[model samples]
Target: MFIEPDYKYMPTTTGISLPSPKGSRFVASCIALTCVLCFVLPSGYSYGSALLCLTCIPLLLWFRPALSLTREDLWILSALVFYVIAHFVIIQYHGSASRYFEEPSRFLLGIFVFLAVIGFKPSERSWWLGLAIGTILGGMVALWQLLQTDLPRAQGFMNAIQFGNLCLLMGCMCLAGLGWAHQQACPRRWVWLLILAAVMGLAASFFSGARGGWVALPFLLGLLYLCFRHRMQRRFLLIGLTLMTALVVTLYLIPQTGVQLRIEQMSSGLGGYMQGTHVDQSIGVRLEMWRAALAVASEKPWMGWGETGYVEPLVQLISDAASRTQVAELDHLHNDILDTLVKRGALGVIALLAVYLMPLIVFARVSLRASPEDYRLRAFSLCGLLLVTGVIMFGFTQAFLRHNSGVTLFAFFMVVLWGYVRLAEPKVHSE
Candidate 1:
């Protein structure tokens, strides 16, 4: 945990000038390691994070972190609790709901991860190194798979969509972190290396044919600009756009990357869907699933259809419309909002929205008053906002939280960044 919280009476920020807890650096390193472990391993790495959060509980009995919960912090903790309770409420603690409890529990337990950050204040260097190394290696693995295997898309150890979307999200994290890199020793070297890592992460996603996450790009870049506009020259924006355009063109032209084929398939899917010719393609299937999800939600607006309960009625709805019911065969409603609406109903929707919006409220409030010269604070805030935005956008086409990768990465990584924000003590100031 952190510097031993005396939460009853603490300063504005956890920026105390005191020796850190003995062996706290070791604990901090363990925390940082999870960032890399996420991309390198399958579901195994998230266990490490969960373990760290668990480790904090006993330590809390010994001494609190030298920190206090701000208004925003309560919101963070409350959201996690709400998320967990919302799950049990929806399923009535029955069937697959018991097994599905694992994901929601991570959110509730992640409170310790936040507390750990407040106490130990993990080294920023280790965190950045972990991401840079993890993403680069992750990309290499995907590249090897594309070039060597018969599989059309590269998926390290999970679904191609999950693997690719995480890569895309983390890659954007690196890009958003440019300000932090600029402040390091050998600034230019750190900057370029991070840029390269960002490219590798994005490239891996393309190779995986996880085009679903690509929909977030324009908004993601816009957010990055907002976070770092003070530091960027007009010419820098132009250069960035040029590089992004060139990367897209290159990937589309390269046959082995599979980006070209994916784009073509998407175009054809959209073309056929509109013209009403091949209405059973990938896009059409997802579209029909969405329609059915809405119709089904209308049937049971407040208390949703359970995991398996929704299928019969959903199929019946599609049949009544004389539309393809193949989507019922799928496990989830492709959209996260719709999925929650279908299974958990309106209350679940509230819980899910709280998870996304509470964190945004916290980070955006801090960033508003943060000085432009505070690169680390700004970077953390930018990454936080990007995390929320990326997840929401990713959820539009896929129920990302349905997968293990979704819950683990978003819950823990969120607290880690919030911890950094706490360390920075974001407030009105001038350099």
Candidate 2:
């Protein structure tokens, strides 16, 4: 099925040019806009991701440009390759192809997103504007839900954790956008718009009552401080201090917010947990799952129990009926790293670390550069850093990649930012 193109005698007489840059840009913008819209309407988000992938194939072939792979891309590819190999081993050992097919299929989907974004070559401004639009719309929907819903949380169109994490990532992106716009000396109105989006996105995350996003708040602020340290020292200091003060005040006054309660529960559970008592709490349940996961992991330290070997064995290992009941309900170990440890063993954990480490190293390299021409790329790199950190932090309490929103959002934005940065790099060109 794979035909080698004859570069020597490619049909120039046909006069068929590649897709117009304008058309490609339009499609890329639509993809960004739709992704944001899906934050508030996640039922269609998966389908939108699929459509983006489907569209990417013809676009890439028409362009027929050689894809450029950065060092980071190679690293990410290695991690993905390791992941696929582990799954393939599981399939061969277990004689069932379901596990092998499912996760690899998702990775393939991520590859499509990565390829499509790079192929379209969207402008930086267009991509930021699309994200801004999505953030504003998502904020409005969350606000409306806050006012109308009887439930304790305002999750918008998705579950609380997903909505909260989406808002958190968007807020960081908006901040980066504002900083970039400032550096570019863009219109004051556009900067103000980005500020509004950042504020609203943070507000939506707060209203969602998902503390996982809040776990990354300090890291987000730290990144902002680091990014602006040389450029706007005094200004950033004042803003940072004021924001920190306000955050402290908000936490103190809003006893109704679940954050404080969640922390308390975690603290209490930890204390009781260390004393050999199994406390029935959110943190307690995760501890139980983690212990069971480790036990199973020890049984097959090399390649692990695979996807199929998780639940029943863990349940049987739990001596307490109550703990077993709770453990049985879990689809994965709550922690992403731990899940990888349990599913794929030590090698899997190393690969998982590479997945996070490679991107971090890549972005940090660009972000730390002093070139003015690299400002936008640096800003985007910072955004990518914060997004990766937030997801990793969230994964502590939940296996984020196991679900639809987590995988789709992470994969889409991961490539979108990486692709754009590579495209903008003067030394590297897609063609």
Candidate 3:
């Protein structure tokens, strides 16, 4: 019989091939360089590192011209553009253009990193491995910090705020890895290591004593449970509950350590708030600052004083308080929402919402539609959850968007979300 050749049995010449070794190496090096710039750079080094990272954009475009117009890529680009515009507007009105430049530049550099992440089709396994390395590195630094005699000294690449936030985010990442490892059908020794890393990270977070970070923990855990709910078997759920119970017991039993100190501070701060006392301790000053910011916002409802206007406005408002009590240097409002309202008014608020909320919307949509078997989707969903939690919690305590650390984190989350959207796109072939 003149039967057709078995196509399934024959070797196919038309299959889609992965990137070549050289291309993979190039992409890996780019990612590594970006990570170093992010982790190793000093506080104000973002300005220089951002410019260096920007040079990679043309290089990436040259390698993959097809990446220019992807939806995820465009979202990030648009966000950066909006941020830059907002910065310019603040400068035009406030005449402190230089102050906003660093943040905008960091945002732009983050866009380049996001594009680079999309260019490399890293598997979910590979991403976890990369995060694993970062988590371990951060954890070791924190452990060493813990062992030191200096109680209040700032060590490592990040400050107390940055370190605390990084630890919290890294902890979430490690926990996600632990969840994935448990679900995998292979030897899962790495899960234990990840669990240890998470503990260390949490410890570091507490040691750093960033009060806002403590508020972010429950939100992060809740998001994790929600994202992995389907994959959670009955036994897994039972074990999780048991573990949680054990953790609570351990925490309650242990002496004041790590986050316990911050918790105590928060309790005292809440007491001060309820009593309506200006104690200048714990979070009392922050509440006072927020009230002052509100007053400033009321005075300049339309467009506020401008980017750096809060310093003078805040100082003016707190003058009586400073003189009567003993407070010094009321620099920032310490609340992102209030700061934006007082400084940039309604337009700034809109920009801030656009920058943060858009990613949440995109990632939520992707999470809902992603296939159950897809791992990258899972990672993105977890990352999206972390970002939302971080934004909400950190917003209450600090003007996270105004500082380089917060801006950097915001950009990192955007890049991860961009990676997800880019990976989800259907490939087209030219005839």
List all candidate RMSDs to the true structure. 4.1, 5.4, 6.9
Which candidate's lDDT is highest?
A: 1
Candidate 1 vs candidate 3, lDDT winner: 1
lDDT of each: 0.78, 0.69, 0.61
Tens digit per residue, CA lDDT, model 1, 1-431? 22222122233355543324443664566655676666667664575686677677776555454656778889899999998888877767435647868878889878888887767556666667667767887788798888898987999878899889888888888887788888887889878878888898888889889878778877887888877676899899889889988997898899988888888889998888678666677886777668878988998888687777888777775542334556656888888999999987898899999999999999998888778788888888888999999999999988999888888889988988888788767441112
Write down the TM-score of every candidate.
Answer: 0.91, 0.86, 0.82
lDDT of 1: 0.78
Candidate 2 residues lying further than 4 Å off, grouped into runs, are: 1-18, 70-72, 96-100, 183-185, 255-257, 275-278, 370-373, 429-431
| lDDT: the better of candidates 1 and 2 | 1
lDDT of 3 by residue, 320-389 (tens): 4643143235445667878778878887777777777777777776677767776545665667657766
The alpha-carbon deviation from the true structure for residue 338 of candidate 2, after best TM-score superposition, in angstroms, is: 0.8
Q: Give the clashing residue pairs of candidate 3, or none.
A: none
lDDT of 2 by residue, 323-376 (tens): 778778777877888887777777767766766777777878877773755566
Off by over 4 Å in 3: 1-20, 30-52, 68-73, 120-126, 153-155, 178-187, 244-258, 319-328, 424-431
Model 1 residue 297 CA deviation in Å: 0.5
